[model samples]
Target: MAKYKVTMLKMGTLNGEKSNMTMGRNFGITTEIPMFSVAVEGNGHKIILDTGIKSLEWARVNLGEMYVIEQEEDETMEGALAHIGWKPEDVDIVINTHLHYDHCGSNHLFKNAKFYVQRAEWEAAFNPVENQQCFYFEELFGWSAVRYTSWKFLDGEAEILPGIKLIPFGGHSVGSQGVFIDTEDGVVCFAADTIGVLENLYENCLPNIMTNVEDGFKTFEIVRNNADFVIPGHDPVMKKYQTTDFPKVDKIR
Candidate 1:
């Protein structure tokens, strides 16, 4: 057992007045256009979650041409980590909420780390193309930086690793999922794109894209009702609720 420090590193931010697209049906009214990931430190190990989007070049051809991204802090992941006194290779584990381009583009950045992805997502992502607007594509592969990949094949409350539990939540994707960290601030669930933004917390619904909107709603309810800190997809409000409480996320100086 271990304790973790979770920080929302601002990977990129979308600057537009009408950021929320009219996502109809189940999901509705998303707020903010920010991409985030968590940095974990403690237990004599370093871990991070969801690498965030790639350079806008990849975004231009794939993740909707309208999805323009600007670097929030450093030019590259390595440079960004150095600002906080970490190295790309320092990360021991990289969690994949799902394989969407925006969420996993930087997966290769942590070259020496082992990747933990949901079995369903890993299967779906590598299989035939699913979405016409699929954020990830074959073009994004062949980086060769990921030393290894593992799957959470079996379910029923599995611990992804020490202090991190891979709870089940198949939304956004067939096996789209999230993480529950017994962090210093309590359990922080990384519901990647599972809930597009904080609004999903209140609405308790998901868009038609989700495999099962009801399941998505139920998943959201579970995370929102139980976790100490709920990390929603693309929500910028994380920067505010965060404090210098954990190691990787907290100030080292």
Candidate 2:
């Protein structure tokens, strides 16, 4: 069995509404959520989960002033990978938890990697639900130089490698998936937007951004049942586990 070392890469930050994350809660409040890309390295393979956001200027112009995004000098996707002794082309597989702009923005960087996305998600990226339409940007994943040629779509839950499982549990999007990587610490779930923050799993709340609220709640139970440790999609607290070590459950808070 290959014991992978999972590292959370902080690519940038977004200033968003609190209710946008907690769903129906924290309505008049705003919060800063860190954007991260998870790196799973070991067993002669390198994999990335969710590729982080695009340039700051692109976000401001395309997403408007409401979605203020910022990326520091060291927070670029290239910088994040370099911090772990990796470059984009060195990655073998890129799994997109969902097709949101913030999650797949750097998909183009991995020119030599195969990009995996759920079949439903690939379709939804082209024709998302009314509310989610604005969040999907085809250029980020489809119109890139690598384009659809290097893209692969999964029908549902599948394993990309021996110790890496792609669990498609949709709610956050039409085809949202989570990456479960077997680490020395146990199965660590990179619980995408379905589990936006640790509080959502601990408090049994749903994120405001979702295609189906009911499915979002069900995905929470999936995480509780399967994950020994969890890395949330947009939580600042995950920054503590940015190292190359396999993080244990107790270390997450």
**Candidate of highest lDDT:** 2
C-alpha RMSD of each candidate structure in angstroms? 5.8, 2.5
Give one digit per residue, the lDDT tens place, for model 1 in 175-248. Answer: 66678888665777777677666556655546444666677767766676557666766766666225443212
Q: lDDT of all predictions, in order shown? A: 0.63, 0.82
Once fitted onto the true fold, the runs of candidate 2 whose alpha carbons sit more than 4 angstroms away are 244-253
lDDT tens digits by residue: candidate 2, 110-214: 988999989998888899889998998888877653566788889988978889988888689999998898988789998878878877877777888878888
Candidate 2: TM-score? 0.94
TM-score of each: 0.81, 0.94
